[model samples]
Target: MPATPASDDLREGSGARALLRLATPVVASRLGIMAMGLVDTVVVGRYSSAELGYHALAWAVTGVVLTTGLGLLSGVQVMTSQAIGEGREADTGAILRRGLVYAGWIALAAALFLAVTGGPMLHAFGLSAGLADGATPVLQVQAVSLIPIIVADAGLFWLEAHGRAVPGMLAMWAANVVNLIVNLWLVPGGNFLGVDGAVASGWATFASRLFLLVLLAWIILSWRRARELGVLTPAPRAPHAAQAMRRVGYGAAASYFIESLAFSAMAIFAGWISITAVAVWAVVINVAAVVFMVPLGLSVATSVLVGRAYGARDQVGMLQSAGQGFAFTTAVLLAVSVGVWLFPEGIAAAYSRDAVVIAGIASAMILSSLFFVADGLQVVAAQSLRARSDIVAPTATHLFSYVVVMMPLAWWLGVRQGGGVDGLIWAIVIASTLSAVLLWGRFAWLARRPLVPLAQPRAA
Candidate 1:
């Protein structure tokens, strides 16, 4: 196979253009992810605030597992880009295959873990018996959907690494259409299965995810370059390839797990306040997450660019890519923050009909906007670090910022001090700012060090 050219032209000015071109579709694709959650939140919140609380608690547990699995699969994107940078495009297919298998095992393990322990875990949080009980079955139903979505992500990441974000983006929005249809049909007592409310929403999630997996598979398998890219063939045996992939993933998985676990803990703190508090925090976090998709997309794009540069031993290209990514992320998030701050009440009103819940969400939403730029910068910086294989620093930084700093502060301010939902948002603001500073500093330090190429894969 001919060696595919890495982006040799990725220098000072061209890097920004490349970043924008890749980030546009990638951001839209990430939005499709949060858009599904937004739909579920809106549909269930309007149906019943109590049900929304059930949904939020259930998701708090599921979200942690989901993110950790996605983190473990992050190597698919990193390794694929690295291989292409090394001019070995054929190797990406093996990476995808390995990623799919790994994704399957992680999903199954997580689903079973949730099925067996989800109820007890919720109960252990000291939530009211009714809240715990209502969330248990919903969590289990959500567990069933995990298998499809995690596996689907492997394919999506592979496509994104090849600069083919459009297919995945289109497939995701198509899945959203499926999710919306099911949500509308089932969430408002329209289903004959006797399930309604949050549980029905859970089933909708399962259906849509299954549809997404099937659709994405068809797209990948049908691509004209599929065979040429080695998609149809077994990956040549390279003893170190799988190990390299997992090595990259381990740090990312740890970082994602720690951060997600801490954020989910915020929901637990809100639960301790009131069911109404949980419902409000749900709306605030969902909106923030929706906005966050932009930066997460930027992070993925930047990581690909940096990983390629790193693989090619091009320090200048790596720095340029990282710089462009940071500037773009900051500018985009600042604009989004202003928009979110300007219309918090209007945004909150769309999620729920209850005056009390809307009021709570609106205030918290305003507070949450303060963290948007910091949060965006932090993720972009972290991903850039990982692209260059400086993985442990980002993981350690997240652990300190989120678990050590944000978690206790959230409890202290939100629960101990009676500041409620607004307090939780404040905690996030502080932690995110600190994380951004630390991660960017680490990236700056690493970029100054001598460059080294990763070990090449052994021949089959």
Candidate 2:
């Protein structure tokens, strides 16, 4: 028999070093992406609140529709991590090649649809003349970048899949460096590009990030160890490879739509209160984006750990991975909650300085921190579910929490009850609490299996 795989070593390690080995840079990767979004808001805010809201409108719309594309990796990341655990490293390429095929269609349809419909859709949320005109072009051009983001996402998921999270983190940093440099040159005040200068900056960001991410993908793809990510060149093809890809892709798309629709609605509804309210809401949401990195990183790590355990068929290992993830997520988030509490005004100031803007945003940030703590729980649990290939249960939990319950609650707090931003905060809290309860319940049910050694495939 072939020697045991490294994945078996990880499944066995279950030590501090092993967990850190997975989490440290994965957390750094999360931070790098957060920094990039912060740079976008800070740069755009240099113009005017109206301009910032314009970019905000564009980005919020995309978040609702485009972010779901990230779900495409629910399989690649979790399943690949599991496969690697079984020492089946040589069969990954066919899936990647097929992913590119699927992502292409998704990026194109999503981009075209957004380009054609941004104005009317935005108007429904009460966009103004300056905001509407400015928002439409920014989103349309940015939509073009979505194709690259989707294509590049394959590389990102692959890195996480292989437990090499550092490369993905570096790629995001490299993209950020390029974006900051180019956007500065592109968006100087009163430039020939006008508000379109901002558009040019967004375009530059997409191009540079794509180039850097693809380059990193090439370097990593060439590793001797990474051979598993490739379908064995001479290995006989699996008969159902194409079908598996379709199944994973379609499932991811559905998950994306439901989640995005619910999250996006929060922004759309906030826009109705007042334009300034929209601006304040935008600042709060973006700041939440910065605060969210910790949990996001933890969740990705949890997913990898869960998938690896599942692959090894190690019942105890699965529970340990999830338990540690939950512990780490809560511990870190609790610390973050303090920072969010002690420095709400200071944090809001980093993104905006207008008195009305700061005051309105500060109230939301304090309350929103509570929601994210709960939100952090759900993120880790849900990703853990994805890691074990138990995708459907978590999907149902999120649907019920965000759509069935959170939406109406948000409307009540922010609108029906005249609570303003605090209302939105409570709405998120409601959804997040429900999500945590359901995910914990589901994870408990899945962790009761017996161990089985991974079966090595026969040589072709």
Candidate 3:
């Protein structure tokens, strides 16, 4: 009925301690999201390396839309957190309602665009006919699943902005269980569903995502404060609220698109090299993504804290939260880097048993380990900038590092130099380090200036 003293103390604690408390469950939730794909990759890779190749190719295409869609709706989280700090907590429900409408349209548009053009895009890549043909169905299925997952993300973002990360963590892991069980049943090729291998993995994804959306909806409906929090009913429209959401969404979406394009293009480049290269890239990227969830979770925590501080005009708190996030991310990733370096083969073997694939993935993982800290740093920095409503610089950094630098380098090293998968990993390493340096430099420059108060929500 009443808030505990300890809870208030935690809310008012030093940035480092408060962030640690927030980030722990946030990281778990991010990892739970990644684990669903991890299970799909492992199951399909085990069933057939060829099928795994199909799965990777399909995901490469779907990932661009999925990630960009999430980015487009990130305004939901950013605005909600700022609302709390601005003493406009009542605005959060309106943010969620708007986010759902925005997310639904984006998801539908992406699904349609992908369904119509995905196969042709794969064919246009000049990949082997077999690879392109096989991936088309998988891509279509993955595309369909995006509708539910992206809409569900609005609810997840709303909950996390309110310091309710634990529920999302629980719901995501529960969905993971569903994904794993279904994958186990359908991926080995003899199911009544008439789906097998990578295709079965796609169906499992659709099922799990649907479950996730339903679970989140239930949570929101049953939340005791749902009405009081303005989550169940719409708040009176603030004049600039819609514009504010779009402002954040567009910048975030651009940054996300540029970066996702870089990685997805690399996957295509790997396919251009060889089927084996595609498989190895899948393994390496999968490992990197699993590790990436750590920083991503930290990014979410840092953004929320930074937004609140910005809203309250607490520049010192904003800086402290961001700094602690960077420090914590580097420390965790450094340990991860060491572990991955020491046991690349052990790690790669979990996805595929093929000796050649394992060797190739091991070598790439070694190089990837070297860049983990840089990768983690850049994300936290970028997210912190967004929370402060300084979104343009991060988009520029991505454009410079990923589009202007990473893409060409990947092609030149991996293709022109004939270095195969190792070459692509090296390209990512160089770009990620550059992005980290540039983004942190930008943050430092921004920190020295006077803090900009959070913008008022515009009239709807």
lDDT of 1: 0.90
Could you give candidate 3's per-residue lDDT for residues 166-249 as a string of tens digits? 888899999999999999999998899888989899999989999999999999888877777677787566657888988898
How does model 3 fare in lDDT? Answer: 0.89
Which pairs clash in model 3? 238-458, 238-459, 239-458, 239-459, 239-460, 240-457, 240-458, 240-459, 241-458
Point out the higher-scoring one by lDDT: 1 or 3: 1
TM-score of candidate 2 on Cα atoms, chains taken together = 0.91
lDDT string, candidate 1, 1-460, tens digits: 3433323323224778888877899999999999999999999998999999999999999999999999999988998988877777776788888888889999999999999999999999999999999999999999999999999999999998888888899999999999999999999995787899999999999999999999999999998778877788887766678888888899899999999999999999999999889999899889988998999999999999998888788999999999999999999999999998999999989999999998998888888889999999999999999998888999999999999999999999999999999889999999999999999999998877989655664321
**Per-model TM-score versus the true fold:** 0.97, 0.91, 0.97
Model 3: worst 10 consecutive residues (lDDT sum)? 1-10
- Every model: Cα RMSD to truth: 1.9, 2.9, 2.1
User: Each candidate: what lDDT?
Assistant: 0.90, 0.72, 0.89
- For candidate 1, list the clashing residue pairs, or say none: none
Could you tell which candidate, 2 or 3, scores higher by TM-score? 3
Runs in model 2 with CA error above 4 Å? 1-12, 126-130, 189-198, 226-239, 249-252, 449-460
